[model samples]
Target: MRPLDPRLLRYAAGARWFFAAGAVLAALQTVLTIAFAWSLSQAIVGVVEGRSLAELRTEILVFAGTTIARLVVTWASGSVSIRGAARVKSELRSRLYRAIGRLGPAWSAGRSSAGLTVLGTRGLDALDDYFGKYLPQLILTVIATPVIVAVMFWQDVLSGVFVVVTLPLIPVFMVLIGWATQSVQRQQWDTLSELSGNYLDVLGGLSTLKSFGRAERQLTRIRVVTERYRVATMKVLRTTFLSGFALELGASLSVALVAVGVGMRLVAGDIGFGPALFVLLLAPEAFLPLRNVGTNFHAAAEGVTASEDVFAILDEAADAADATATAVHPGGGPSSAATAPAGLEFHDVGVSYDGTTVLSGVSARFAPGRVGVLTGPSGSGKSSLISTLLGTVAHDGVLTLDGSPLPSGPGERPWLAWSGQRPGLISGTVADNVSLGEASVDPDRLTRALALAQLDGWDADRECGVAGSLLSGGQAQRVAVARAFYRALRPETRVLVLDEPSSALDHETERRLAASITELAAGGLVVIVASHRRRLRDIADVELALTPAVAKR
Candidate 1:
């Protein structure tokens, strides 16, 4: 389903009542405002006809009372509208993040970080007007504008028709300009989103670029992106300026026509001077709201454009889908946490993406007390098989643990420990990265896991530096693996899946990793590692090489 617009109604439904009340007040203000103008005409006409001073005082009192009341109601309505808008923007951002969460990694990989960011910052921002200004103004246009026209018509139907006719011109010109700029605005939004992503990437890779002595080259690339963003922004601005000019000119010309008509009618003695003057005065106010609507809507365009991505994210399939719950350990066995007693088993499990096969019909078992090692070439579907075992990837074929089919989709799992080639670390002390959500690791367990992962030297008290800037490749990689081991270390953890365990490690580090694997396997842990490092073979019992055919295409 298409996602809901980031709107106020979703957050503070109670505020919707306030918005309604505000619209009503705004409508009343419109009538009083016009009535105050009429009263002025009355007071002026009465005074000119040699009315008494006391009558003039009463006339002035009426104008003051009505105008002041109108201002109060208008202010009250504006307050409600603004509050509603602010609340909706905040709620919508939270909703967007929530939606992104639902879709999981498979779904998230398809979207750009820059696009998601724009949706959060700009997309939610659009709701400000969607709730506060555009909506209220639109409501006023629907309820108040007509009432204004009716009052004008009551005094002089011809003037009423003249005022009503001007209303269509403002929107007609606006829509015409809107059509012309729609494509440009879309292009501008795309450019802005891409620019945000590029900038974020550059900043993220700044250190890496500097290390490679390519920071200057990246800076030049960033300058190019900045110039592109500027050009796109200027294009949108030019079009917006043209649109405003058209709307302004159209509204002004139409109001001027009303004035000329009222003047001509009064000169022809078709109506009294007082009524004609009233019609002339009220004509401009009727069209002002519509013109304002166009301008305010223009301001909202950026928000609206950015909100599309937010909406898309909200509509995405969640990260924790039920269809992706089952996991298989790299030993080609069902998740060990399975309690059914059927034990973990993988029967001809296979997986493919975009017609390119990653894992093919393979059968294996990881019943407790048996440790299985998955050994193969770099692209031999070893890691892909591990992903299926970890329930991180959707796959084809049957996986059963303890005799029952494994859960296939969504939600956090309690039993698995799978680490990828490059593990991520959040900003915090070393202790925080190691536990993730796992309870505080005991000092002994922490030390042992760190030693096994070859990161025993890291001080728990030091800051990890945004993604652990202080850690070397081996350290970071080991830290990631240690997190899995420490996070609820199931000594009986049925399957331990490792992808490229020795990718960047030196011989000594690789030796330590192999020793850790051997110890874990000897303890009846079914361990699987994707490795080209033959040193791993010392600890591995079964070497399974996934041929291109074995892993599908």
Candidate 2:
């Protein structure tokens, strides 16, 4: 709600230049306004004093020149503001995306992806009105209002006093109206985000809903959310119209007061006609900037709301980064790439969510060239432990590799490979999915990975459709596992983690996957698998059992 947020300058470099340009243009515009008013007043008074048109040609030409200059300046200001808005929007979107990536999947798990999509797209686009209309007028208000009032005071103290006293009334009314507008605008924004999230959820689960004969029920839910958004939008528009009327009325009456005072003084011969006319002309100019600011503020409120949300996310990412930087290492220093670990070890690691401990005081080590299996009942923290190793979940105790402390987060752990329970595949060919994150797909590695995942002779050119819809449940699961295998085949990858890789496979396919995991361990990789399948535990060189704990809701 601020006229300008300091964080906008911090996040978008273009904003700094925009403010600089706006100030220059605003100052130029103010000077031209004063010049045009004085020139026109002098021309009128000279003609009334019996001077010919040719005798007053200088004042007439000056009036026309200032008018043209003002027009050019206005156009230039608009062009600069538009380009600046585009640059700021692009920068904000890019920074927001990078921050989300750094926060990782664990941080995003509890958030709504559809809401975020709306924020990055439609929400930020609202800033067009803010930068183009509201901010320029704000700059003018700061630069033009004071100077015009000073000119008025120089001409006549009574008119200047009237302006100074009544100018504050517009802002007083503006503050009251702005408070109401902000409340309704924020409600509208939230309802829009809700509507987007609900629609996305229905679309994503449409097949399952149809299978249960409950697809029609989702239509009612969507309709309810859409109606809520529509009502919220109408409320915002209502407030905007009412607030605009209030501002216009206040400005008009204030101008009328100045005009009435000037006319009476001119008739009584207490003030010269030229000075009276000049004071009257400058009266509206003094109030114009403030009035425009109040009117455009409502239009820009939504962008202001969206920017606040963006700043919140950016701040959270920064705080997370700071905490990670100050984290204590077991070895008293971070491990270097030259001192890469030969094994993975957990020394009393624990994980918690909302003050409820899910895994506590668990310790284990899986050496290179060995397969380690984690066995536990549901909600016993099998996946939680895997999350700690993946650097997605914060842990209570130290995690070290070959007696050296591991770096925080997956971005720092290029030597690790993992596949979760979900396929997480995009629309692409099988080869593209298998060789993800690589600059170029290596056909040899792609074929070998698919073969190891028991997908031998599968089409590398086959499409997976959206979220791997073209593939069966078993096929999608294998493709996800193959993605891990493809990464594990790299020379630098030292550890491989799989969370329920065989959940969707039959007994024969599970056996083949177990043999593949054993083969990977034999090739000097530390393979860790979290599953309840007895066959997977049978192939492990080390087995860790987790006991379930009561979780507070």
Q: lDDT scores for all predictions? A: 0.71, 0.90
- Model 2, 1-553: lDDT tens digits are 6768899999999999999999999999999999999999999999899999999999999999999999999999999899999999999999899888877776788799999999999888999999998999999999999999999999999999999999999999988998898789989999999989998998989999999999999989989988998999999899989989999999999999999999998899989999999998999999999999999998899999999999899888888888888876332232453675568888777777767889877878889999999998998999989988777777677777776777766466778889998999989999888888789988888989999999999999999998999999999999999999999999999899999999999999999999999999999999999999998999989999888964764
**Candidate 2: count of backbone clashes, pairs at least 3 residues apart or interchain:** 0
How many pairs collide in each candidate, listed in order? 23, 0
Q: Write the per-residue lDDT of candidate 1 for residues 272-361, one digit (tens) a residue.
A: 988887777777778777777777666666666666655555545433343345433343444445444534567677777657777777
Q: Name the lDDT value of residue 259 in candidate 1.
A: 83
Number of the top-ranking candidate, with TM-score as the measure: 2
| Candidate 2 residue-wise lDDT at 527 | 93
Q: Kindly give the stretch of ten consecutive residues in candidate 1 with the minimal lDDT sum.
A: 1-10
